[model samples]
Target: MSASIAARNIAGVVLLGLGLAVGSTGAPAVAATTVHTGVATQLGPCPTPTEAPGTEPIPFPLTSSVKPTDTSTSTVIVPDGPQMQCSTTAPTLYEDITYSSPTTGGVETDLKLDLQIPDTPGDKPLVIYITGGGFITADKSANLGQRTYVADQGYAVASIEYRTQLTGATYEDGLADVKSAVRYLRAHADEYGIDASQVAVWGQSAGGYLAAMAGATNGIKRFDIGENLNQSSSVQAVVDEFGASDLAGMADDYDAATQTAYMAPGSFINNYVFGPGSTRTVATDARANRAANPATYLRRGVSAPVVMLHGDQDQIVSPSQTLTYLNALKAKGVEGTRYVVQGANHGDMSFLGDPDAGLLWSTQKVMDVITGFLDQKIGS
Candidate 1:
């Protein structure tokens, strides 16, 4: 079945970028936005940057969409797959390093991680990449490609393994596993040539959800369980791309058609996080979603700098999910930046083999926006 249920021949789609500044409690909401709104026209080759890299800059102005305009009635088939990230020809620095081993219901599962170091020297900032597999499978081996790209930009990348519902683990348990990975890295920072202070959590889809959760609950003791209790799990940066912020609200964001498709079968968000029999959109007042909401734990002083990206055209995970999370965060007086990519779908689900879509969202220009945020906040 096709992931997207939205009409293909969309008209006058708006492509814009919003940079929000949300201050502490009792503060007002402020924003600095530069929007290039029109039918998507240009999408290829990174435009020449006027300023230096790693600054607060949206390197590529989103003017037009690479998505082809279909005049006649049309249906799109997005080949489902992992996110299309940078190349990873570089060898692994370390692999299969167990970060946590937690026994649940008298069963023990060893959670391991693989690290990728750059060919260039220096103790590098670390990016803990959480793999996305609908939360039923957390494979550290997938998306190993992004490691080399990040490392080449003077950062180290570590893909970690976390417990999924398939292992009878809850969402909280998965989050705890992420914290354990951070603490473990900090404990052995020097040994691994990492700068513990400069760490970021970057993930796609479900991984993005966990990444946001980690940042929202940074340094919170309850999530820190087993090994390296002395070290902190708080990260300096967070990158969440098309992750579900509100579980039930996610269904609410879907249109009638999309909801029908999403609730059809194999609904991971329902089965894994919200539980089975929840294969339906929920009302906004359903506070049950707050239970696992990362934004629910956001504190002004505690939460790290966050950079959120989403595809406006995504049907799997609506861009509104990002807004819901970020808006909730802003109301609490925290700060974050949101970049909405036009014509892109959730992760690579809709654009796996589509080169135009690939160039639109996963190019070096896009990576620069990400690495730039990391550099400004974490000094990688």
Candidate 2:
């Protein structure tokens, strides 16, 4: 028996979880705690629609001869549907609240967020969720129902709207909008029952890129302009789900057809990101993308802990993007984790354990990966 090993378990796995540090072996830094029900598939906190036909195997002594009967005529059959009420503690939603009003794309529009605060009182960590729409339509409400999983974890989940190309927003403007949302939350923390000091950013695709940039550029004065000057726009954690990392090199990861499409003049990826319309040249466009890269700002201490998740089946932003981002993280000595969800596509909620949704991965597993990391980082 070794005395040094005696302090810890000798037979089980030993993990050195420093925030979101993925080991060199590339396993998930945080393994979710699974609760096994009697059924094989229901290893989550909530009950799924499946239960392998329950039966009382061991019969009790005949205290009373009982027989089941349908006593109520009110029982009615409904059409086939996949929705199941998982929790009674519904979050308090504050919808379409104006956070910032910036004139982007020549249109001065009020950017808003739909905040979901848990039913439990007291302060909780705020997760600023940024939606992805390829920078063409960054809607605040897309996949909003999927966000409830994050909110149900006793955290305030704010789905924010950032200005996109539709609003004539450049990558810089979009980043500013995301950061401004953070400052707004801090300035009005008391009203929302949020622990402003403990804040995180979670985004998908383009939103993911912005979220990563926000986390990587913490303490920098450039993007901290606009609302709530008194408060800092720094976030403690970041979750980049299938986001574009290195914009300049991203085209290289695409297939020949996609690369051609991406490089085509006036392409939305070109027009919205780098060069506008026919004005885009390869050199100038790549320069703009390089400027928007989070790696440009990532520093060891300045960047928040980040956990980048990607689906292996993602066709839009190739899975290699996560690796590219992770390489940048390693170069800066920043703490980062990489998690690839098998059978999961891009940011499509349709595949989240619903027959209509395609049932790629159980929603419980996804939320556990996301909220679990948030819990480790800034969870109250």
Candidate 3:
């Protein structure tokens, strides 16, 4: 059979099997399936959940393993699940902690962050959450549920509000704010009972891009800006969900037809990176683009291990972006892993909106991968 026909048959079989499985359970099955672009292989078995450090039992639907079929293809599966939920204890919040930034007139327009520590005692690792809004719009509380859940998992979580293009902030300004947040956390670790050494940055979409950049360029002097220059802004690991790694390659990822169809006015690539006046200049400018790329900072010794999760069918940020970044990490011998959610789309809503069975199944898988990765790389 032709490649296209063969793929169709495989998809049919997988969907049929999923339907039957879901029908028995009376839960909606997520119509998500792994889409293969090249030669296909037998579907791999779902990974076994890895045990996390700490007394708590590891969460369900965990991604036990991640295997890349080639540079471009891979499969990720989560076992059936018990739904994930946040902790009952309210977080001890340190609201709107301001940090000085040169970009915003020093102290007059200082950037702010909201630190949320679980009520549970002891010094815990810190995870800074960055929200996604195409670098144009976002608030610190964008992903409250996930951040709260992570805090409940015994980590200090900080939901950060950074400058955006709308506020005259460039990518450089955003990175500076993120680094400043890290420094602030470390400086105040004692007060919050946080283990400053075991810090992690987690973000989705635009925030994912920042997290990746922060993790890749840890300890690099140029990206470190704002107050607390004496303290370090380094993180132990990164969790990037569908973040754009290489800005230059984003427009290039689409073909003539795709680009024509999707590249509308005020696109994230255009407004955020290039600024308001020019069209396509930022996308074409090698120097500016390189400065913004997470891949540009990657080297043998500078990077932290990364765990990335992206939907195979994501139209906003192509899956190839993650693949390319992963390849760069591998080339430098930096530890990194990726989970491509089959038939998944751009955001959490896509995963959460799946059929009842698919929602629980996918959620468990996502939590498992993230928690497992955190356990292995940064502990707890």
Top-lDDT candidate index: 2
| Clashing residue pairs found in predicted model 2 | 105-167, 105-168, 350-357
Q: What tens-digit string does per-residue lDDT give for candidate 2 at 271-367?
A: 5565344567343566676777888888888799898877654545666777788878988998888877654445443222223322332355555
Q: For residue 181, what is the lDDT in candidate 1? A: 82
- What's the lDDT for candidate 1? 0.63
The whole-model lDDT of each prediction reads: 0.63, 0.64, 0.63
**Which ten contiguous residues of candidate 2 have the minimum total lDDT?**
16-25
Would you give me the overall lDDT of model 2?
Answer: 0.64
TM-score, cand. 2 vs. native: 0.74
